[model samples]
Target: MPGLAGTERKNIAPGLAVSIVLKQDQRTGKLTEGVVKDILTKSPHHPHGIKVRLETGEVGRVKEIHDEE
Candidate 1:
């Protein structure tokens, strides 16, 4: 999917690289890239995006899921 959704957890597994918008950067729409550490959103779908914590310990909503290859 282009935009991250809560239901797309399978598409965004741990260790996967992704771009996200941090709580502070929501206004600027800044994208932070990092490896997924944990999935915080339990819902199947979120309007904004699936919230997750990166390996770097940065928490944010997934904006895009990057391919491994």
Candidate 2:
């Protein structure tokens, strides 16, 4: 997570429609959102970060993982 916090880019979430920032895993394309459901760093495609399903029930990868502001 070094050199990531100062990117000036906000994290993303499901249902918020985001552009692919960086695709760590083509199988699980990375996405950046302005809003999200549950944000957490888990063991998945992106060992860095991932966003959970919102009220809409959708899960996706977060190029940048940050709490809701």
**Deviation of model 1 at 5, angstroms:** 5.8
Which number leads on TM-score?
1
Worst 10 residues of 1 by lDDT: 1-10
Instruction: Tell me the deviation in Å of residue 40 in model 2.
Output: 6.0
Candidate 2: 10-residue stretch with minimal lDDT: 2-11
Pull out the clashing pairs in model 1.
7-44
lDDT value for model 1: 0.84
Residue 35, model 1: Cα distance from true site in angstroms: 0.1
Error of 2 at 22 (Å): 12
- State each model's CA lDDT, in order: 0.84, 0.42
